[model samples]
Target: MIRLVLLLLLAAGPALADRPRDPGGSVALRVLEIAALEARGEEKRVAGDCLSACTMYLGLSTACFEPDAVLGFHGPRLAWGLPMTPATFEAVTRTMAAYYPPRIARRFLDDWRHTPRFARVEASRLIARGEARACD
Candidate 1:
């Protein structure tokens, strides 16, 4: 009986967790703050791409480009000449494209060559704060 009850509760847990979600409001703010603080400590500890991606997926555009946020999106490995797991590159890009309009998303995805230094800072910041763009 206990095992059955535990299974039932576990199944219900996901449903409860998914409903009335913030869409990353509180999470994004927290991440932004952390990133800023980290940048202060370390000269190059920023990850704006992660933050941007996370925000896009969450569908919280109210503060997408707010003054506090440093806009930066992650691009494919081909641009950086690094090995990116296909899954991650695809997942991140797809997430960005999913949330942002095609024009903006495309700009972010394909424009890594012009990725600003500040964007890296923002991405680092996003990663430090335990926030991520929702991929679902």
Candidate 2:
């Protein structure tokens, strides 16, 4: 029953893109792209640098990362480094953390979410920690 429903959703979206190969960009665009990929219900493999908003790929149930793939993360920023409301910051932080497993999510919320520098988490470590599976 659920399998049929998932297949129906997959039929509705365009094919998933080739392995999300980019340094990352507009959060809004990535959000839409991720939704489409998630709906497609296909495996997503990450083999290269997926930084910034690109890290959101982890949100998808089918997403996998090659051992060497680098997924970078940092705090949200506004245009011209403008300040967002406290609520907005918290919301964005939670959204990003939501992609990770609970233990890592806590680490992200505690340290990485507000860092000025990007926090790099290797796919190997993610696989070791059971946060993600290795790509075939």
Best model per TM-score: 2
Q: What is the C-alpha lDDT of each candidate?
A: 0.44, 0.80
lDDT of 1 by residue, 1-136 (tens): 9999999999999876643322222333544654664555523222223344344532343332222234444443344466768787666556556655554556566674245432333323332443433121
lDDT of 2 by residue, 1-136 (tens): 9999999878764534434456777677877887888898878888777787778777878888899888888877787889889898888878777777887778878998789988998889988988888887
Collision count for each candidate, in order: 11, 0
TM-score for each predicted model, relative to the true structure? 0.33, 0.76
Residue 15 shift from truth in candidate 1, angstroms: 42
